[model samples]
Target: MTRLLNEEIIKKLVTMHDANRIIDQTFQGFGNKTVINPSKVSLDLGETGGYPFHEGFVNAMPAYIGDMDLAGIKWVSGIAGERREAGLPYISAMILLLDPRMGEFISVMEGTYISNLRTGAQTANSLKYLGFKDKVSIGMYGAGEQARFQLEAIADLYEITELRVWNHRRETAEIYANEMKQYVSGETIICNPEEGEKAAQAEILITVTNAQEPILLREWIKPGTVVFPMGSFQEVDDDLILSVDKIIVDHPDQALNRGALKKLHKEGRVTEENIFTTLGQLAIGAVEMPNFQEEIIMCIPIGTGAMDVSIAGHVYKRALEQGLGENYSFINYN
Candidate 1:
C-alpha cells in the first residue's frame, strides 16, 4: 500500500549501481519479437483515437529478487508517438510489485528510469566482458539518455581515463563531449565522430541511437573492438550484422528470434551461422572468448521484466526499511 515515485526509483537505481549490488534475474523473452512501431494514429485531447500506433511486442516480465524476496511485473508496451507530444517517452511502462507471501499490491511506479538502468547494467556487463581494460577511449553513437547512462555505468565499472563521443548533430556531440570533460577531469576525445570514427579510434564502441538504418557502418568499426548496439537493431549496418566474430545476446532464444540478429535473419541478411554465442551461454560457461582479432562483437539487451522486478523488489524493500513511501489503499472493498 506504499507508493514510490520516479525520482525515488532513480535514487534507488543510482544507489544500487553505486553499491554494485543490484540483483538481476531475468525470465525468458522473445528472441526477435517483431511488431510494427509506426505512429499513424492520432487522438484528440478529450476523445481517444488516431493513436497512430503500430505493433510492438508487449511482454510479461516477472522476477524474484533479493532482500525481501522482491517480485514484480513489468509490461513493456511499445508505442512511438509519445516523443512528438513532448510529454511521454517513446516507450511507456507500468510496473506493479506484490507481496509475494500474501499477493497484495505493494507498489506501482513509473518504469522508464528502471528500464534504462537495466540497459545500463547490461552495457556495463558487456564492457567488463569484452572491453580492453587499459583502453581510455570510448566511442559512442547516439547522444540520448541511454548514452549518458552508458557512460555513467562505464565510469562506475572502470577508471575511464577519457572519452570520445559522436552524434549526428554537431551541437549535441559537442555538448556531450563537454559534459563528459567535467566528469573525466582528464583529457577527453569527445566530438562528432570524425567521418567513420567508430572503427577509427574507440577501443570500446557503443551505439544507442534511434536511426532506422545503420549508423555504425560495418567498415567503421576497428579491429578487436567490442560494440554495444544498445539502440534499435535496425540502426546497425548490415556489414556489422554479418561481419562480427562473436554475437552475444542476453538470451539467444529471444535474441535469435526478435533481437537485432533475428531482424537480420528475417531480412535474409544473417542466420544462425552469424551468431557465435550468447551471454547466457557465456555466463553458464558454454562458450569461451576468442583471440583479440579485428572482430566486432555486439550484445543486445531486450528489456526483461524479471530483471526489472527483481531489482525493483529489492529497492522497495530497502525503501520501506528507510521509512520511505506512504500507505494507501488501491482498492477499497466494503
Candidate 2:
C-alpha cells in the first residue's frame, strides 16, 4: 500500500518547528557528506501558441539522506506571471517518497506547502547557526507568499522590532503590511519605489521577487546586514555580490548554475573559490563563524531535494502514525 496525501493533510502533519528541525538535519547531512543532492535539471518552456509560457520552467530535483534513510524527488513548476494573471497559484509541486531499500514508491504528497515552509525554515536555521541580534529588523523586497512565510519563521525566532517592505506594486505592499501585522510586534512601513534605501536598513534583508534584473544596489546594503536572495533569478546587483564579506550557499554546483552568482560566474567574475562556505558547513561547525557584527554576508539558499525528501519522509511517518492519509494497493500479490 502507498500513502497519498494532499496539502491540507500535510499541514496537519507538519508545523514550522518541525520543518526547522528537519531542515537542520538536512544541512548537517550535507556537512557530513551523507546526503546526495544532485543539481536539478530545468526544462524551459518557450512561448507556446498564445499561452504565456515564455518564462515557464519545470525542474526535476532528486536527493537521498543516508543517516535518516530518506529518499525522494520533487517535480515543481514555476509559471508566475501567467498563473497569477489567471488567479491560480504561481508555484506547484509534487513529492514522491521512495523506499530506500528497494527503490519502491511509498507516498505521493503535495509539495508546494512543504517547499515554502522548508525555505523559511532554512533561513531561520541560517540565522540560528550564523547568529543574529536579539531584536531584529527585517527588510523585505517582495510581498508574496514566500515573504509571509519568511516573516512567520523569523518572528517565531526573534522579537521583530520593525519590518520595512518595498514591493513593485504599492497596493500589494499596503495589503501585505496590514495582513502581516500579526507577525510583528512593532511597525510595518511600506516604502515607496524611491525609498529602497530606507527598506534596506535592517539587520536582515530578504529579496523574494521575480525581477529579472537587479533591484537592490550595493550601496543600499549596510554593514552587518545578512542579505538573502530567495528567487531563482537575479535580484541583487553584481557590486553587492562582490562586496559582501562572505557568501554562503546550499550547493556550490547549483549556486554556480543559478541565481546572481550564476550570471557572475559566466562573466568570469566569480567562481567556486569565491564562495566562503556552505550553510551546511556553517551549521555543522566545520567552518569559522563570520564577524557578524561588522561584516555583511550573503546567504544564497537554493532549494535542495534533500530537504524535500527528508521533510516528506517525516510527514509520511507522521501520517502513518495518525492514520491520516488514504492508502491504496498499487502492487498486487496475486
lDDT of each: 0.60, 0.88
- Tens digit of per-residue lDDT, candidate 2, span 46-133: 4122344555777899999898787899999887556768998878999998898987889999999999998898888888777775
lDDT string, candidate 1, 1-334, tens digits:
6566565544753453732335222311111121111111222221123333442335556655434455677766555454446565566676788777888878876776777776777666555545346434677777778887777766766777656677877788777766766456456654554555533477677778876667677777767777777664466777777777777666545565554565777777666566676554454344666666666677775545555665666556666777666667877866
| Top candidate when judged by lDDT against the true structure | 2
| TM-score leader | 2
Q: Which ranges in model 1 have alpha carbons more than 4 Å from their true place?
A: 9-13, 16-20, 23-51, 54-60, 64-69, 77-83, 131-136, 198-200, 268-273, 284-286, 332-334
Native-to-model Cα distance after best TM-score fit, residue 309 in candidate 1, in Å:
1.6
Query: Among all windows of ten consecutive residues in candidate 1, which has the lowest summed lDDT?
Result: 31-40
